[model samples]
Target: MSGSFYKVECPDCENEQVVFGKASTEVACAVCGTTLARPTGGNADIEGDVLETVEAR
Candidate 1:
């Protein structure tokens, strides 16, 4: 079983970035440096709007 990916939209900058579903560390927006996701030892806590969920291929 593998984790998935997500396309998250930054609320402040509206920058779209690919984030790991089970990210071990904090994920920030590339353009605005805003916190996008936080690690919880499982699926990350997505802060911004989750545009899509990308399955592992």
Candidate 2:
């Protein structure tokens, strides 16, 4: 089975970028020049909501 799509937020600029495929390292931000951990970044609002749902339950 394949791992679920995961998101990663930029720690520096708080920018978001989607990771459409498998795991990767050193994915750069499309807007900024920051080297992010993962390329899949859920927008701040979406990120928050997902977290909320998990926490609520």
Candidate 3:
């Protein structure tokens, strides 16, 4: 697999973040402070069914 940093859209705050080499327990929206699903593998393994957006603005 390609080991590189990539941006992931926060399903809560809609903030784009580079998740690829940062250890974290929980991820909150960088813009709206909405708590996101627990990031798998620091933050690298982002972009997937990790979040759910019901209604957005």
Candidate 4:
């Protein structure tokens, strides 16, 4: 699957961040340093509140 961006809100600190859908590495919240997403080969395993799916232009 193609990579995409997603808007996610940290459950711990409620900080919002943009993350890669198929991230090859772990993604963390910038504000609180909370673990947000983990790489899972295809789509990343998200651990935050998914605000929306970002559309590529």
Task: Give per-model TM-scores.
Answer: 0.89, 0.41, 0.41, 0.88
What is the full ranking by lDDT, best candidate first? 1, 4, 3, 2
Candidate with the greatest TM-score versus the true structure: 1
Candidate 1: lDDT of 32? 85
Model 3 segments more than 4 A misplaced: 1-4, 37-57
Cand. 3 TM to true fold: 0.41
Pitting candidate 1 against candidate 3, the one with the higher TM-score is: 1
**Can you write out model 3's per-residue Cα lDDT over 2-30, one digit (the tens) per residue?**
34444567765567664543435665566
Give the poorly placed runs of model 1, Cα more than 4 Å off: none
The candidate 1 region of ten consecutive residues with least summed lDDT is 48-57
Local distance difference test scores for all models: 0.91, 0.41, 0.50, 0.89
Clashing residue pairs in candidate 3 are: 20-44
On residues 7-47, what C-alpha lDDT tens digit does candidate 4 reach at each position? Answer: 99999999989998888999989998899999987788999
Model 2: per-residue Cα lDDT over 1-57, one tens digit each: 243433545566666555333334545667776654443433222221111121110
When 2 and 4 are scored with lDDT, the better candidate is 4
| Candidate 2 wrongly placed segments (more than 4 Å) | 20-25, 38-57
Q: Look at candidate 1 and give me any clashing residue pairs.
A: none
Clashes of each: 0, 1, 1, 0
lDDT value, residue 45 of candidate 2: 22
